[model samples]
Target: MNPLLCGLAANPALPPELVDRLLTLALEEARADPASQFADDLLHGLADRADLRHDQILELAAHSDTMARYLAYGGTLDAADVDPGSMPNAAVALLDERRGNLAWARFLATHPDPQIRWKLASCPGLPQDAVDLLAADPDEEVVKELALWTDSPVTARLALHPDPEVRIAAAANPSTPLEAVIVLAADPELTLKWTLSERTDLPQALYARLAADPHAGVRATYASNPGIGQELIRVLAADPELQVRRAVAKHPRIPLDLLAELVVGDRAGWNLLPRIAAATPAELKEPAGSRHAAVRMLVAQRRDLPPHLREALAVDPDASVVRAVAPHPGLSEELLRAMVARHGVQVLAAVAANPDASGPLLEYLTQHRPGVRRVLKEVAEHPHATGPALLACLADRTSRPLAAAHPALPPEAITELLADEDHQVAEAAAGNPSLPRAVMLELMP
Candidate 1:
């Protein structure tokens, strides 16, 4: 099919009469040359569109094309009255629909090919009779596939399968009986224990056992579980493994007091303070007073920091803290402008990217730092950027793609951009609403 016709067929807003005309043309082409793949493809593509009127879908469904009829029936063998036994492709499509047709599912369950049964095994809506038959299939892969489903009638039996891989898949299914879960939890296979450790819905005793697992990896995964209790968090916080402790530090439920204790050292403070969700005024003071520049820099990155802390960090002796807080929206305009005047490129780029930077500040930053990509792209895309700054950005290769889409670009600049060497630049220019209506129609495919 021509790209234009394909685009039109996919457009839901295409008037019904136009769709009818396209379908009529395609069918006429198919009749004259039965081997015409484009006509067949167009017919097949339109068969599954839910937006098509019933009459249009009927035309596709009644066509001689088997694939079109198959697609129209929504992948149901019985719905199309195509022989269920005749086509392996039909069976694959039918299984995908997961229509939960018991007879067809049962028929496919024992089909000579194990691959069909393997596909059937993963269907979430498989009937119990089909599940029962497939679960006992001699083909290990089919049984292994069936073991993945929580609703599989035979999950209990599959849990004890001789293959640990099969048992591991069964362990992931919540419906696997508790006795089997306990067995898998203690099983020598570390992967099975690791998988089971991540599931919080398991009984607390099982979680506790997994938390104390000899392997630190299993304990870390358990520590990160959202549903683990405060008591477990406390235990994990003291664990000798730094990863286990780090996981506790990041847990959403980690107590503020525990977090305070964890940040006693400079290394811990640098890693943990920025992640604390809540902090008291006293907690803020400790980090603010820390001797290490890195510790203070971490505190400066906190979004919930108080205005006083922000103001103090904006002028911090260390350049890192100052740069960290430059983009903070809470900084006063006067303070921001002072930083702009005093600081170099890093601070200038940060200020330009700040959402609260005023239009005048952005325009000045854009004109001064047009070569700095951070400033150019940020200012070009900023809603507050003026026509002159956008036009400057359009002149630079680094920012042209973003600048082309800016509504401030004059009609002539946008038109020039519409044919720029970069396809993305041209595409962005084509979408600019500032493009004259006459120019827009001329660029249409």
Candidate 2:
């Protein structure tokens, strides 16, 4: 019943000593009960071990359990030893289970069952020769599975496949040559053109072609590519479609000056300020002082703001701006305390969550706001939480789970929390690294 042995047996790769230990345990279990599943699983693990002799593999395969026998035949048995006549179904199942085994793939290549051939087509790590054979499969579904193999030479053949769906998959594959991509871009189907527009590696010439595409959807897709040149970006910026312009505004490489203009001039672009705020910190100074509270609210959340900007936003007339700034670590102590006094409990909870809160400030919040349990949970999890603050959190049933997992919680309290009836409390206690080794052995499955 050792979980480590079961885990080791399930893994295909194992260190020599661990494999020896697993085999020893399996043999001991098999002595007591000859048909133990763990012994069979361990035998299967040994069958996959490259260090074992061919005869040892044969012995394990001969006595393996039904499931292990099937895997062994597919994985380790030579083609001559397999009786194709006696076990037709097992032969097919073996092929399905075999991964990257070239001999098995060759044997199954001509399997009359298209379904069996389909399995070979989808199996990963198969030899390139085997993949090339599967690509010409008469069944479209089997051919479709070949599309998933990006490195295979067959992917080039799949690009020219008559089936548009298969062609689309080939276009999306990273291995598809740039020449094939150009052909797909010119496909009469708008969907194929749109899919090609999303590829980041497309050359600048393709971007220009896609930018002027008659379909707005294709142009919009090109607008989102960060690699699109500035000239193409400006053209897309003036695109009549609001969606296309919005995509232009969000491009990471969009000129900062242009982004600032879009924020003020385009109504659709205003909603994208959060994204713009991340790239253009210096350009946002004017937007931070915007008369519109929504624009100011998004700017207040930017961590790159100077201390002076944080202080200014902290005292803004909008409560939302104050709430957004409350959790910022750089906010002045005077501003945090003033906001806590003027605003409601939610603002106090935010301040409590800020790791930079001084020990004196945490103490004041813990004592003065005894009834606010939400703030207590934040204080309990804060890295700066003191012993007294954590104790206050542990006393409340509503906040005890967060407190139980806090690294600052005393070792003795954690031991007590391990026995807590609440599943969440016990689960949190189990995850704490400081939990004694003996306790972890009992709690971890």
Candidate 3:
């Protein structure tokens, strides 16, 4: 490379092509002596030349280190060089350089293509004056982009737009002014009215009003949003549309009482409610003894079941409910045993953790069943549960824990068993670990 050519390559104002070839030569030789620029200057010149195909120009631009290219650009790129398709890419580069100048941006704002115009309007660098002009643009596409605006007046104008699509777009915009969304709730079009149902963007006042909207869809749309009022949820739970009803059934906001309505009686006779009812917590249940096996089945899984619910469900005719109630945490030990006679020891596991289980049941658990004993042992050692019911079992002499239980209990029951003394009592305590450690140690020798 000639010394003059080399020096010219370093010149910031040199024609882009010669600078590019010189940069390539410098990079090819690994000339770190202020010469190995990531891209030759000519490629940037090619990128700026508008007559070249965009892809070809991009191909050249892609070679330059992005940071280095912006450094090379040094605030000289005019609006003419900003291509419509490539406008975002170049604008991003310019913004990154903090070169959000009027000339570079003005070219983009007034670009012939709406795509470019929209992108520029959406850009954070778009001047407030430019945003005001673009927000009022008549094109729906331009109007829609204006909703991205954070300014209340600018976002509101588009939000108040007469077009349903534009209003829908505005309602969906995160920056849409709250006042603007309120205006749409008053729109007559079903779509705009329906847009009021969405809980995500609409204000609380607007969302509540929409829930009462006379249009079924508008009210139904409100039902779909979890933020809809609880009273409104009750109303929507009865919505005629199966789609709306189904949506309510799945919404966490829908009232439990309303869920019962939705979960019962087949509007279509097949009964979608049965599947839904099968998952309710026992605390939500109203039936002392629910008829549906699935509903009764769900009642068994609730940890918060009230005593009335537990007592009522304890005698359920369904063996599954009996089995479920047998191990219910809320059920008394005596109640658990009664349920067991109905559903058998297989059902006893349900109440194994019940703090109210009788010592006799614990004694029975230690004898023949490994699974039941394992559960009883966990109840004894589990951090959250106090195993007072296991006192008699832990005090017994011959008690033996089921082998290979998870969260194994410590060696301490023998002392509690020694204190127990009764033959049946001692045997039951041997398997239970909640027995007094000192009593077990004294009995060890």
Candidate 4:
């Protein structure tokens, strides 16, 4: 058998004689015809094997292919024998692949090429001294790479570096110490302050300070920061810039009274009422009787409101308010039925989807509102849905997917759904625990 063919077979246990013959032929051919495909194949095969002689290793390193050089030099080749300057970038990368190759690492550490220095910066096992040296590298790219090493002592130095780009990278690194971040926060560059404002651990004083920043963009960040307490929220709520005040309205921690004031007073007309309505029950009460229908609608959706207030909002003249109250868990049964009778199917759909919806109401909506697909789908999946209601939903092809998955679906309906033309329907049927043992077994891969 040809030695090259034997090597290509990848049989690690090939006889020693076969290995020696293959190496000899491959080296000779590679030297005579450097571009030979057969020689390249044999060289690659021998590159991964540990049986290469010292001369064979050197021969492979000197080969024209960079890949062949990387494979050869990646092994036990001495640093002196390998010329780092002449080697291609790819070959240089291969040397750093293995950890703790101190000789190669130290030689490449100062290897004039910035690309080599950049790669070294990412090595976790790189020595601290080498990291320090790279941190001060003239090239911003090299320094930027070092900025990512959060634990490096050099990150603090880079944070204050004259280059805004380097400072920005350091500021963004979560590992950069708080002291360094505070300095970056005050940096004249709006971009640096913007990056620093995103840090969750920003000091309360900083939040307050950034809130009054000359630039709307910086104050906007402060407005959006959840850590901003009521004091900062109050300040931002009254900001001259409508955009900043709008951001305060969306803030999760803004005082309820302040949000109400913004809803009623801010002339920006940004539609901040929905967010205020979503506030905790305690907050919702602050804006309970605001003239804005949007604000009133949100207040009506709160479950914590007193019965009188909820009942009054439920019967409010505004259809949107009535619709909002329809989904409130604390909504009275009388009010829900009244809303369903008075409002259109849109309001009824919200009621049908509410977990607090009564069984009788769900049945009523299921029977009378079958034309609305959303309402029917919600009714089909309702925990209180009646047997007849689920059957009605299953009968409609549009609502079958949701109906087929309902626990109330009968075994016969499930069997019928198993053969549904819609794959989603069939898949839902397969996953239903009520499916027969034989049916489940058939669904197995």
Q: Over the stretch 1-445, how does candidate 3's per-residue lDDT look in tens digits? A: 1322322333333344443454455444443443543334333333443343444444444443452344325544433445423444466455435564554565555667676567556555456676766766666687676665434456666766777777777776656667766666666773555544443755566666666667665565667586666766666677777766766666655555566566556333222233233445543555435556545555555555677776877877777666655655656666777766666656655655566665456556545343454455544543333234344234332222221111133335333333343443343343233444343233321
The models' CA-based lDDT, in order, is 0.70, 0.67, 0.52, 0.68
lDDT (C-alpha) at residue 266 in model 3: 35
TM-score of each: 0.58, 0.55, 0.37, 0.54
**Per-residue accuracy of model 1 over 1-445 as CA lDDT, tens digit each:** 1433443444344456666777887788788888987687657655545567656655664565366337524742243443457554455455556543346788888889887788778777777888888878889888878887637648889888888778887887766787877777778863665767545577777777779988887788888776688888899899999878877767766775576566556264343343454566677787676776765776777766788888888887776667777778877778878776677665777777767887778778876642476788888888777778788777668788788877777879887876577766776676565766566445333
**Higher TM-score: candidate 2 or 4?**
2
lDDT per residue for candidate 2 within 1-445, as digits (tens), equals 2333343343333345555655666666766788876666556555666665565554554453343345444466554444443433344455455522356666666668787777667665666666777777788787776675446767778888988888887887767787887788778872665666556788888889768888887788889787688888899988988778877877877775566555554444143343555645566777678876656766776666787777888898877677777787777677788887887675778788776888677767777653587788788788887767887887778778777767667777776776787766765664454555454444323
RMSD of each: 7.9, 9.8, 22.4, 15.6
Which candidate order results from sorting by TM-score in descending order? 1, 2, 4, 3
Question: Can you tell me which runs of candidate 3 are displaced by over 4 Å?
Answer: 1-107, 119-130, 148-153, 160-174, 187-191, 199-218, 264-445
lDDT of 4 by residue, 1-445 (tens): 2332422323344445655666677778777987887777666766676666677667667765375356634664554456655653434455455423444555666778787788776666566767777786778888887786546667788888888888888887767888998888777773655666656677889777767779997888778777777777887887898888878877876666666666665545343344554565555555667677766865765656667777788888778778777776777677788887787775878788777887778778877743577777888778887667787787667778777767667877876777777766775565454655554434322
Instruction: Using TM-score, give the best candidate's number.
Output: 1
Worst 10 residues of 1 by lDDT: 75-84
Runs in model 4 deviating more than 4 A are: 1-177, 186-190, 200-220, 227-244, 253-257, 264-286, 304-309, 394-399, 442-445
